[model samples]
Target: MTLNRRQFIGTTATMAAVLSAPMVRAQGKPRVVVVGGGAGGATAARYIAKGSKGAIDVTLIEPTRKYYTCFFSNLYLGGFKEIEDIGHTYGGLAAGGVNVVHDWAVGVDRDAKTVALAGGGSLPYDKLILSPGIDFVEGAVEGWGLSAQNAMPHAYKAGSQSELLKAQLVAMPAGGTFAMVAPPNPYRCPPGPYERVSMVAHFLKQNNPTAKIIVADPKPKFSKMALFQEGWANHYEGMIDWIGDDFGGGTVSVDPNEMTISIDGEVTKVDVCNVIPAMKAGRIAEIAGVTDGNWAPVNAADMSTKADADVYVLGDASSQGDMPKSGFSANSQAKVCANAVRGALTGSKVFPAKFSNTCWSLIAPDDGVKVGATYEATPEKIAKVDGFISQTGESSDLRKATYEESEGWYTGITTDMLG
Candidate 1:
């Protein structure tokens, strides 16, 4: 199973032949296979494919033909944005000489160094990057499952469910109640659930003033808590209610058919519900035996899995300390992982890695909140060296500017991923 010099050279030649028609193909370079063409995987693919100037054959295996970012998903739910605005295509990656395979990865044969695709094929890689994102703990809420999603939408992943939740909100009666069950700490996008509450309240205030939003949170505090509370009070007075872990508001079970959630042994019914369950690393990461508890463990030096040297995990799937599981973090980690993979394949020196992340959430159309951090790897782990949070009571003008900056970041990052 060892790749001899002749065999390695022959494989490179075959790759070159296969990519001859593509003007941007990297000839005589090691073949790299990346799974999950989301923020992290796509960014890694683009950087390694383009940065190497055709010195690496990059193939991205992703099931979806298009990607929808979770960042601005609330805007869509609040009727401020179209779903199409969040959707992006893979054509840019293809144009950049990346072989974009539209297929789900069922498994990875670590011993064989091959990725098993759902389409009855396998692709080998000199190095692999995986960033499949998060999967919900299905049975975490009693009586809740896929079948129940129609009545109680968990718009955590931000696609069809987001629209479904929004539609329900729109259809609700003027004095109806909207209940949100927020998960415990260490979930993807910590500020997300609260932000969702704000957005929903904003819509209700303008369109249906009598409508109310009750947030049942399993945690005592959440990301940007003070800021969110301030925004809610200042904009939509008495429209939002929060139930922390101490209150009877933390959810334990759900009856989707009844639109009722049980918290602190009391059942409360709502006209509409958004139940975001506890999350874990995506199913593929668990199947690959790379997860520690709920997330994958990686060496901060290069995002390589502690379980497997050949496999690198990034994005919301990895247990990146002091770094939120935000899209920005995933994108930054992708570049670092790409450089490490390139070095491993070509026997080049590994570069010093630095990672950054910023997550912005909107309260009103022009009112935004943000938190960011920067990290650098030490011999032990990735350590946060610098960070900042949006100042409380910042003027609407500043908040609006930050929102615009978020849009610019989306465009820039997407370009970096596919261009």
Candidate 2:
């Protein structure tokens, strides 16, 4: 069999395994083991391998063969996209010189600089990048837990959960109620729950016009609050009843069996409930001992974890100051980390770290809104330098343009992350 340079780089580890041996490091080539192949890990892995030109060994550990992005899952729920449209495979990365491992990362041994797999093997690395995303905080929402997900799907992780929530939405009785228990601050996508609310309202408006939407939010205000409120009032008028912390929205509980939600001592039977509990870094970060209870703290300049310089954390899991926990932020952070790690591994030029993020939300049809900011790495943190956001009462044409911009960005970012 013949192999190109990139293909050879990808298959070297496999060849070592075939010989019942550990990965070969004949010439002191640096290896980077990335856990959680979402926006952050995949981009970092690909960038390192591509940038090094086969000088660095990059292996990505992700459980799923196909990854569905959480960023646009709401669009899927809103009927704007099909499930297949959001699903992505790792073949591109595998072909790009990254060894994509489809297995669960069970543990991390920082001393040995190795990651243990649930399938019973380990991969040693000179550097480890973790971007495992968010995990629900246990008992954050009373009466709701992982076991109750079928009855009240969070749909936060995308893929099957997103499909399950859509199915529940479709199965709702005519004019039945759809409820959401919004997560607390510092969760993935600050505007996500609200965008989801907009999408659900859009779906309900077309299919079940009489259906009602209720949101019990722990926050008094949310990202793009004024814009989302304006969109809701204009498009989904009288359809959504949002209970904020000021109105006892934070004080809530639920029952999956009865399909009911209680807010401020008032209980109401619900047809569909989405409980997005408080979130923390994915468990792997904690197991790696890089997390400070809830999130992994990292240096703003390079995204290297403070716990261990050789170990890096990215995306929603990292408590990098000022960046929202969105896929855009993860992708942005990944590039900086990749450059730094590649420089550390090889004699590459390391550039100054700069980051930017833009979060877009579709309200109803062509009505969309967005908020964004540019950031620089400061000694204290990743400090926001300047920002912009879609304004309230904007012309429909401008709003439509914003929505179109978001679509273009989606295409560009997905390509950038995987390719």
Candidate 3:
């Protein structure tokens, strides 16, 4: 299928195969192979590599040489940040003694514990960590595929497609229409598509007041709905249009070459179209027999796969209940999974793992909204204990401060991921 930069960044076929591959290793140190290097995989690889202090051999398999985060990509579209500000390198993990492999993983030999590489080589690991992230459902959007992505960019993963979307915005006519197809529920970043619409609207309001944005969402209610609606009315009234599922917001097909999206069998042409299809765990996860439905089922405490004892799955690939698949959640799960893996390898006492996640979305340059929750592991699942959402009608100054705080968090998280 046609993939945008964001979707491209989250691809994990190579990593999944690596985790399931079987091979022989010299008996010296335990070898850990981490697949996918966006948020969770990169964090786990770095932490395990550094925490073990050469006691463990860590090899990180990722298709890309660098990572671009989705967290602050909206800011880039709004002209509040640069692409360079959101991009990160794997040098930090390499410095931590991680053997970083920039190649695709094609298959895994679970019987032999070896991972087949696209380059015709295999790597054996004692323990495998899989964090390949999510993938788009192929037919979720009819007539849309990899070839169509060039004309209509999702910018979901936050790299080259992000740049393409930005360029499209810059080149659009003053009163052109920008259409966004919002995915169904249980997808990554519940508030993401709305936040993106706001950011794009923010840019147009300042530069091209006559321009407009339209959101076709399959869900009637969304994360931070009240706050976003309020922000749009107060700051960008008459500039944005939202159609809920009940109002035929669902997209049935898209012709990227024509810049047209079909909603409820009606064709609508636009200056720019961003189609985000339904998604599931990366394909490799499905192929390796780790996924239960669309995601991998794991032990709540350590995120080890229920289907296989030697494998651990985290991030969007794992079925983490009530926790939206955001960068923060992925990073948090990665840290916990890393600790559990270390404990398992060294024969240390394992602790009952606790995890937390916070997602911040900008409604305007200075206005932001946040949602967070703390989770505890139950026998059956990860259950939420305490959580908070941004208080309604908060002061503009407070929201602005929170926005700054979110920036600091982005910096801290990226450092934690690579460092």
Q: lDDT of each structure?
A: 0.85, 0.94, 0.84
Instruction: Give each model's clash number.
Output: 1, 0, 14
Question: Candidate 2: worst 10 consecutive residues by lDDT?
Answer: 16-25
TM-score against truth, every candidate: 0.91, 0.94, 0.92
lDDT tens digits by residue: candidate 2, 1-419: 89999999879865654344233356667799999999999999999999989978899999999999998999999999999999999999999999999999999999988999999989999899999999999999999999999999999999999999999999999999999999988999999999999999999999999999999999999999999999999989999999999999999999999999999999999999999999999999999999997999999999999999999999999998999999999999999999999877664678999999999999989998999999999987999999999899999999999899989999999999998
Q: Residue 295 deviation, candidate 2, in Å?
A: 0.3
List all candidate RMSDs to the true structure: 6.3, 6.0, 10.4
TM-score of 3: 0.92
Indicate the residue-level lDDT of 243 in model 1.
Answer: 88
Q: What residue pairs are clashing in model 1?
A: 26-54
Candidate 2 has a TM-score of 0.94
Per-residue lDDT tens digits for candidate 1, residues 1-419, read 99999999999986765555332325455778888888899999998887777878899998988788787888888777899988889999999989999999898888888889999989987787889999988687777887888899988886788889989988999899998889876788888998889889988988899988888888888999999988988998988889898886654788887788787888888899888888999888988889989999999999999999888999999986778888888999998998888777754446899999888888888888799989998766778999999988898899999989877887887787767
As for TM-score, the candidate ahead, 1 or 2, is: 2
**lDDT of model number 3:** 0.84
Model 3: residue 280 alpha-carbon error in angstroms = 0.9
Candidate 3 scores a C-alpha RMSD against the true structure in Å of 10.4
* Regions more than 4 Å wrong, model 2: 1-26
Looking at model 2, residue 263 earns an lDDT score of: 98
Q: What is the lDDT of candidate 1?
A: 0.85
Query: Which lDDT value does model 3 have at 348?
Result: 38
lDDT of 3 at 104: 76
